[model samples]
Target chain A: MADVVKFDEHPSDTLRAGANFNLAGIDPASTPGYSGDKGAGESLLSELDGKLTQLQEQLFAESRTGGKKRVLLVLQAMDTAGKGGIVNHVMGQMNPQGVQFKAFKAPTPEEQSYDFLWRIEKEVPAAGMVGVFDRSHYEDVLIHRVHRWADAVELDRRYRAINEFEARQTAAGTKIIKVMLHISRDEQQQRLLARLEDPSKRWKYSGNDLKERAFWDDYMDAYQAAFERTSSEHAPWHVIPANKKWYARIAVQQLLLDALNGLALQWPVPEIDVDMERELVRRS
Target chain B: MADVVKFDEHPSDTLRAGANFNLAGIDPASTPGYSGDKGAGESLLSELDGKLTQLQEQLFAESRTGGKKRVLLVLQAMDTAGKGGIVNHVMGQMNPQGVQFKAFKAPTPEEQSYDFLWRIEKEVPAAGMVGVFDRSHYEDVLIHRVHRWADAVELDRRYRAINEFEARQTAAGTKIIKVMLHISRDEQQQRLLARLEDPSKRWKYSGNDLKERAFWDDYMDAYQAAFERTSSEHAPWHVIPANKKWYARIAVQQLLLDALNGLALQWPVPEIDVDMERELVRRS
Candidate 1:
């Protein structure tokens, strides 16, 4: 049996709410809280699966019984930082009924006409759901900042808007988990090259990805600014070094596990009289 | 290694659209088209996982590149018939990004105000996606007939409306797989009792389930009426005997596999200049 990995300090604590956090300072290949090789990390993830499923079901049960709590996992990452992999391998473990997934692409004509958060607010998870945003409202700040689509004043205004938006959601009982899957520029190049070489993966590649690569430093600066501005006690930002796919997967899973664990979810008490219902079933 | 299970006649063929179909005549406990025991059936399901994943990814890739084809799995069943089990065990194996899951409850006031298909139309799978409906528009006819909520004329109109709705979706490139998970009344009684006995599963139990159980024969008739009127060549209904949970799971998995296989999906060819992009990526 693989020894259960325990962390004296939670992965969330190590990764969350950086005051003077430097995105460039973290090594993309490092596994922060896990003391394991790839094999051990993979085994640990399999172990976490059962616990995650149970917690999610309990959360979903709460929803059915008029619980308002929900979780939003905001995943902001560079291309090939394994956002899709995390969604498939991690969120996919739970009942898909309880998972609402939306991948926000560039704004359409109608979408651009509305506030950035307009399209986002429409997709918020209902009571007792885990909503996964592949790329989110953060993009308005990140890409828009790097490309100078919005002036500095407008960009600064977005930061406040985001803070207020998240605060409002938090007040409404949304547990927000914001993560930046940190990857080195070199790692992205290798992964892009791999996609280019493999015909099956070529659908994910675009010349626009390379064009964006030229703005790497600008993107990083924008991310740093966004993190400093938006990281709050209610919703904090966790920067996971994601050069190693296995580590990123487990680390993100652990962050979600920590969040659900904090909810102290009880199986909602049976609302119906069990004895009476059982008798009726038996008679039927 | 588990030997791959090959069916000379697909499970879809054995379980689909019947002119003389009798729901009561079919044995709920029978595992049609599958000659394996529970262990073997499970092993075969595991084997089907990789192929399903690959096919779903190809379908999703097609969606990304402007392919409009999609699949919708419509599941209608009596309470405790393992519809949730099939979703958790089978559909959960695919990428959540590509799977749109909706569990329709009794229509709310807003939903009731519109034509039944209005709510359902809004949830249809986009291009290259698989949409699963736990209980669907069929309920308007089933429960309405059982409870006398609608007169015979209204029910007849609903049948025509359903047929036209499905035909329109089919013409719009939606491959519809309609299924009824048939379970014996005895099996349902046992399952409901089991839920009542297990504290952890009590949330899934309800007093209303027993009330519905009292109307078993009427429901079977409603289901029979539905299968007859709405089973079209473009969209056929398949009734699977679901007494054995393992068999139902693998049977549903196989049905999905057959639908995807019929598509004969090819990997979407890369739209970008591969050589130029590769050079750019290498330089970056």
Candidate 2:
């Protein structure tokens, strides 16, 4: 189960979104592919942390030395689903040099005037980078659909555009991992209440979260439809059970590790005389 | 000395640029504002780390709760001067939510068409956030002048324009900390050679870095001139001796801690009814 957790490239357990997947079919609280004691979770994650960190550095180093490959971890989730925590805890373990994190808030008036992907294209991680999008172009389909902001024809055009975009990135030495953190409505309500209760966390609370919560059913429907339309061979969507924040974090890291390791990454070949450089550093 | 380092807000020690400051004036081997054992440095930083972490989290919390103030930490240096290391070590310690790190590489054709600061203005840390620029607008004067890309009059205009731009941000509730990590020419050569020797670091080696190094003296002259014209009470330029990378990291963190502490920040008042929320969470 542990090896399967680390080595499973297909993400079959959570890759439900595109393959006749149903949002209602998956249990958010259940931990997939692992039946370990909950107390052992942190230690399990720490082990993965070490391996992933090394691979990430190598990915960065390889990219520096003419490795064209890069990875983009596209994260989309509802409020209180722990997107920030995943960034801080999972992506944080990697060196910031190699990680390009862009948090997509509401579109600025300037951004709104451009095509939806205009801002996104500017922010994609460069070669040898592990780029993370806190929210991404997916926002167009999710919120735009929930709010009836897009007409059916325009929405279809966006779906086609997204597929082509990801395909282009894939062909250009990019590996795309799109994940939607799946959390139960009950768990979200509990988390929101918890945030409000703590003085420090109260600041994280937003009235907008509540306003959006009222449209929970509609958002879920939108997500289900989005994955079916946009998910493809190049960049498939994985809906992780997120009520257990640990599971979501661990699973996400495993997915990333698998992606990096799959590249058969090699350290760059030396261009200068190592012995001479060592002597110079020693003298300096 | 430690307290002095933490409290020194003038930035005059490292701000030696223009006609007044010389690249030869300071010792890269020396640890300015610190007298402690080099081995004990991490422990000392660990001590300051606690205070700064709390303050950063509070700044983030406060911002989320409607605090208008934010921080912009601008980092500039020649190649291999450890700009990325500072971001990974110093800024990485803070919560990623509150830290916006942007590495500005050579301008794209699109970026070149617009004025330089347009891209920079877009990336300024939002309210209650801490912004770190890996290489910034200074590149325009530093590289553009070194290469004679801009004529003398145009360079002078860019200096005034940058000053006005930062002054505007200062008036708008942003605390700007502009830092230049200074390394000696000998040290830079040693570091460059070391990168060439190490396969993992080879990818980080850009042929362009060598191209820039060939014009080192011109770049230094450009930097001195820039500081003379642009350093102000609003956004003072700081030059930390970076050969001892740890000392540089600690000092930069100290500068940031000092900036955040100076805000006299308060945790935002509770918006939701605390007791009611507590009761609700307890019920859930």
Candidate 3:
């Protein structure tokens, strides 16, 4: 028999299984650094920026003619895993008028009383607008998993629910991009300790944070399980390794560009009468 | 006696004040267009960017050193003004690692019941971090002022309270910069009308926004009063012209650099021994 290539055995071939890259497995020496992909990433980013700007102008024009679409991005992660950093850098290139951001937190009585998605639903971007969430509904999985706020069966159900929820949003013309920032435990400790030492940062630290830190193993187990259950084809999680912040940021920018690349938009051309154009130029 | 250089009644002095170069009210004709100051702005921005990068690095170093300081910025503006654009563009220049952002909306019942600052306080940046607010507590003065949610006397009290509140935060090492993007009503209408035309942007348009638009004059009165009452030595408001978005963004960048200029921080000197230096050079 002819020799058969075992695709699953090779790391590169494993990528065909819908995992574009294994972020955690990358080694600094072997992997191309962020600046190394600077040419392609920068080109893509600049192009995407230009497209977005032109798209916004077109949307503005269309809104005058008829209405526009909204874009939503949800970022969820463990502590010190770079959610804030990713939002800052990835969206940095876009027009602010077309963007909005909200950071979700512990719910109040009102929010708790309503459906879990109610508070978040209010924050979804308006059409032609971009909305980013620092920590999103997946917190139900991460926090609820670790805190046992929901039972095992319930947690599993919630995971499936999130997928359906995101799919519905996508159907409603909201493009959903979800990212999972992955950081090692050592990095989180360094970050937490750093937060404690800085006077400006002292307010961010609490005695309870240390107590949570002690349960690191439990959180990791929960995260791994969540990953196994919730990652889906419609709204797959991009596990971004965040030890090298700059690289991680660039990776996120590239990921966003990749997702948005399919949305081809054309700028509305200002209707120009030939005579008026000549007269306008002559006047100038 | 030598001729008085500038008497209050002198027309030349008025002309000079109108011609003031550092962004005071320059005449429309002589007001260098947005592109006019691009060269200087870019050069200054590049230099400022370098300094900011260094400041952030030092801040991060101390973030781990023990007890760190944090910085926060609050932005409040009228509708059709350029708050979102400014946030997107100027904040883009910053180092993502140490920066965070939150956009405030109508408060929940819990937020309303507690002190107004509760929801906002939870969103403050931790030490070694920078936080930006899209619309902050000033909303109470601007929106509530026009809506009559607070009576005149209560509104008057809140204005004073805001200055004191921000001053307290400033003293606590939370460097505060407040900005108000000022756009002409005509320009605002132009933008708003455009939003209606574009399908992608249609979602941002609301019938109620037009109703609010009807109270433009009232909002302006409220804004003027708010500015007069709350502009403080510790936390002054920068009123930026938004007719020109590029100019507004550049001005904001300059303001940020000016606010941060006082923090003198240095990069950790390369850990060095004479023998190690010699060995490193020899190996190279």
Q: Which candidate leads in DockQ? A: 1
Compared with the true structure, what per-residue lDDT tens digits does model 2 show for residues A192-222? 8888767667777766787788789999999
- Screening candidate 2 with a backbone cut-off below 3 angstroms (N, C-alpha, C), the clashing residue pairs are A64-B203, A65-B203
Over the stretch B49-93, how does candidate 3's per-residue lDDT look in tens digits?
665655665665565446356667777766657776666567656
- Candidate achieving the largest TM-score: 1
Q: Which ten contiguous residues of candidate 2 chain B have the minimum total lDDT?
A: B1-10
Candidate 2 all-Cα RMSD: 4.8
The candidates, ranked best first by lDDT, are: 1, 2, 3
lDDT for each residue of candidate 2 in B1-284, tens digit (9 for 90 to 100): 23222323333444434346565577767776676555556666667766776788888777766778888988998889988888877876676667777889889999989998989999888887888888899989999999899999999899999999999999998999888888988899888877876666776765667667778789888877888888887888887888988888888887898799899987677667766655654554
**DockQ, model 3, C-alpha based:** 0.10
lDDT of 3 at B250: 60
Candidate 1 at A116: error in angstroms? 1.4
DockQ of each: 0.86, 0.29, 0.10
Better of 2 and 3 by TM-score: 2
Q: How well does each candidate superpose onto the true structure, as a TM-score?
A: 0.98, 0.82, 0.58
lDDT, each prediction: 0.90, 0.81, 0.61
Model 1 C-alpha lDDT per residue in residues A1-284, reported as the tens digit of each score: 55656554688989875688787788898888778778777888889899999999999999888999999999999989999999999998989999999999999999999999999999888889999999999999999999899998998899999999999999987999999999999999999999988878999988788888899999999999898889988999999989999899989999999999998888988767778787778888
- Kept native contacts, as fractions per model, are 0.92, 0.36, 0.10
Better of 1 and 3 by DockQ: 1
Q: Candidate 1: misplaced stretches above 4 Å?
A: A1-8, B1-8
